[model samples]
Target: MFERGTPGADRIDALRGWVGDGGGLLMVGGYLSFTGFEGKAAYRNTALHEVLPVELLPEDDRVELPAGGRASAVGTGHPALGGVTGEWPPLLGYNRVRPRPGAEVLATLGGDPLVAVAGYGAGRSAVFTSDCSPHWAPAAFCEQWDGYARVFGGLVEWLSQ
Candidate 1:
């Protein structure tokens, strides 16, 4: 990721190669992820874009839901859903994204891709398009929910495989 919009080709290729060689890539969402605030996070059209299971919007994709939005599990039978079962606590917000073809939509929030996973070459890549911490992931979702660990643990487990 570039601080000044410069995703150097070398870094992009290196990351692409790493993922292609079976490395697991996990992208967690936040103000600085997937075209964040004021279009600053900017992961729209890079090598990261190529491998991510979700497509990043060219503009800022933050959707604030102070009323909160709950995740709806959609990837039943997928390894990413392993032991993660039960209702999910409400998330404060998330980065809007679309699941690419062949990518499994593991979960959704506000009718958008909240968690998505895909295979790229010999590797795997997954994304949780919401903050793993604060603001978006609130205390209700992170601390008071058992499924929180189950969900993330499942994603990690699936990615590692």
Candidate 2:
């Protein structure tokens, strides 16, 4: 997670270099991830952007779905969505992102990309555009969603492959 601007140029370069050398990277979203709460994350202009599957918006990209939004697998055979089925728990919010060329969108929320995957050099990378813990994901998604482990575990397994 490239949360706030703690990573300097050196750290960003090191991370990119490491991932280019076959490291698997998984970026989890949060108030400090992606464009962040009010577009403060600012990852788009950094070296870490090289591995992201979506183009980060220049301004605040958060969408508050107070009524909640439904997310579902885009494709049935995607390994990252393996064993994930049924209606997902409603999400309270998420980052708005556009999938990059050659990137595969594995899941979506209200028609927007929710989970995306792509290849960067010799490694693989994935992005989950919603917070993994609170505010966006909601407590129900964290504790009661039956497919939670299956979805995330599949993402990790896919990256290892």
Candidate 3:
């Protein structure tokens, strides 16, 4: 799992190598993520995107779901979602993603994919279109959702396998 503030290419290669070598990756989205707003990340061409199950299209709009905004439905029965009980907290923001062929949809918002999974070599990858911040993923960061820890833990566990 990686976070915002990770330096560019160095990190990209590290992550790319990890996935290519059969290690799991959990890429949580943010302003520093895939083609982030205003093309801030365009230079590095995020390595995770190459193997991501969905294609992250550049958009001018910035999504910001206010704290305590609304809860989106989880993909019932999903290994990462299972045992995650209660309403989800508003995710402050996310990068919009376009699902690619063979991608598995684990969750969505307004028909937009919120979470996706993909396989790369002997490893695999999981993506959360939103940041792992209280201001970004309000529910998950604030622990308002009972399944917060479980979901994250489950994702790591599953991806590792």
| lDDT, candidates in the order shown | 0.87, 0.84, 0.70
Candidate 3 RMSD computed on C-alpha atoms after optimal superposition onto the true structure: 4.9
Ranking by lDDT: 1, 2, 3
lDDT of 3 by residue, 23-57 (tens): 88877777767667676766235666777778877
Write candidate 1's Cα lDDT for 1-161 as tens digits. 45688655578668889999998888999999998998898888677888899999989899998998889888766778666766788898899998999998988888999889999999999999999887899998888888888788888898899
Supply the TM-score for candidate 3.
0.78
Q: Which number leads on TM-score? A: 1
Report the C-alpha lDDT of model 2 over 8-110, residue by residue, as the tens digit.
4577778888878888788877777877777788888788887888888888878889999989877557888757877889999888888999999989987
lDDT of 2: 0.84
TM-score per candidate, chains pooled: 0.91, 0.90, 0.78
List the candidate numbers ranked by TM-score, top first. 1, 2, 3
Candidate 3 lDDT trough over 10 residues, lowest sum: 60-69
**Least well predicted 10-residue stretch by lDDT in candidate 1:** 1-10
Model 2 ranges with Cα > 4 A deviation: 1-9
What is the C-alpha local distance difference test score of candidate 1? 0.87
